[model samples]
Target: MPHGDPPVLGLVAGQGQFPALVAAGAKAQGWGVAAVGFAENTTSGLAAETDWFQWLKLGQLGKLVAFFRTHGVRQVVFAGAINKPRALDIRPDFRAARLLWNLRSKSDNTLLTAVAGELRREGMEVVSALRFVPELQTPAGQLTKRGLSRREQQDLEYGWPIAKAIGRMDIGQCVVVREQMVVAVEGLEGTNAMLKRAGDLGGRGGMAIKIFKPGQEEAIDQPSVGLSTVETMLEAGLTSLVVEAHTSLFFDRDASVALANRHGLCLYGRSDGQDGGD
Candidate 1:
């Protein structure tokens, strides 16, 4: 309606700090934010942080598009995590049911890709959340003051490809490695549960490796580690963590690094074509 209004960015908010982070970044850039927060999955704090906010159930795809269109948002970013198990309880609207019925598999990637495609068809572009917050991207090399020991380095080398392979199969992005043996692979229960299992089986000094899934859309479901991750690792007696640099997201970097350093845990970011740190 206004001749010189700032562009509005729509945010499909899920769980965690990611939606809030994206909204803050967009606002800092002098852009308006319209956030559609998921019921139960999204934090209530996001409503006050955004220019406009609406709460929608998980599979209300039709309402999601209508909210963006009504807010004059032509571009949107999908941010944060939707608890996968809880999503099963969703009462999808007709639009979402159609999309679900046509899917060959109910994998995360397939569902998200279909949603992105639907948004595109509805005159909206689904952009990367990182477009607003590039700092969340993992930096290459050792992040903690403590470098990886030889045994840990070996475990990383052993686990990196294994994690990637598992990701490729859409199984999970995280795996626990100890003494060159695979301890636990993340599944529906997620990284925290897997780490707890690894601690029980392998005890302390295991390495947690997380990587992006091959052939998956980076904008939607990139692997991420944050303060909670470090806390879980500490509780699980895991001593080291490795993530794909540039591809994975590292949220709350300062706090996470400080916690890892305090526990003498090694936090390393392995870039493509780079050797594991010693």
Candidate 2:
């Protein structure tokens, strides 16, 4: 873990370009990267970014740990979101079967926490993906071409607390609101699904508000929005996106913002209780 000799980091990747970004960030910081990609869910291109790569079926926890140990990986980071519904198709190995049986609840947080505990028991540390890439965190302020109007600011004020409360309950991080009414709340289906639902319910542009739970752990499950989120908004006919600043990761920031601008979307980064200045 020295300046020049970075720790060997293990990446557990699923779908999307997130894994590649993490690999790029780790390389920039001089870390040797080893990755385990899910057979059906992960992008194969991730193997190219890593020093060593292994493919595993979902629930092959033992194999994943063994691969990391063999490669001298001391720290592991999870990048990319797993498709929860598809995870049902996972074929658990003996170790994974035991781990799954031990879970009190099958929610993502419970499963991940249990896995982290298992990793620690194996003498490996689980680190945040942002450890080497803090720049991915969204800054506080208006982030797109159009600033929030008074009405939209009020909508954000009304929705922010609800979104955070939902997040605290582990329901989800994004909520769509309009005119002080909750249009849609994100659950297992994810942000894009929630956006489409809100658009259907609201009949036009809805305000999207995302926030972290009051005491949410930053190491995992930090609120994330990206170009996909912007595209979802455009398709859903949403007007604005407001997320908790400093705690949120705005993936592919420039392109995301450019897409927002092209779609005339308002993007604001603010504290849970604060309003964007006009």
Using TM-score as the measure, the top candidate is: 1
- Candidate 2 residues 1-278, lDDT tens each? 44556579988887788788889999998889999998667898888988999988888999999998888888888887888788878789999999999877777677777787888888889888888678898889999889998889788878888887887677888899998899999887888898999988897768998887665556666678988899988888899999888877888899999988887899989976566684
Model 1 TM: 0.96
1-278 per-residue lDDT for model 1 (tens digits) = 37789889989998899999999999999889999988788999999999999999888999989988888887889898888899878788999999999999888888899999998998888888888999999999999999999898888878888988998888888999999999999988878888889999999889999998988887788899999899999999999999899988899999999998888999999985567963
How many clashes does each candidate structure show, in the order listed? 0, 0
Candidate 2, residue 11: the lDDT equals: 89
Of the candidates shown, which would achieve the greatest lDDT relative to the real structure?
1
**lDDT of candidate 2?**
0.85
- Model 1 residue 176 CA deviation in Å: 0.6
Off by over 4 Å in 1: none
- RMSD from true fold, candidate 1: 1.3
Model 2 steric clash total? 0
TM-score per model over all chains: 0.96, 0.92
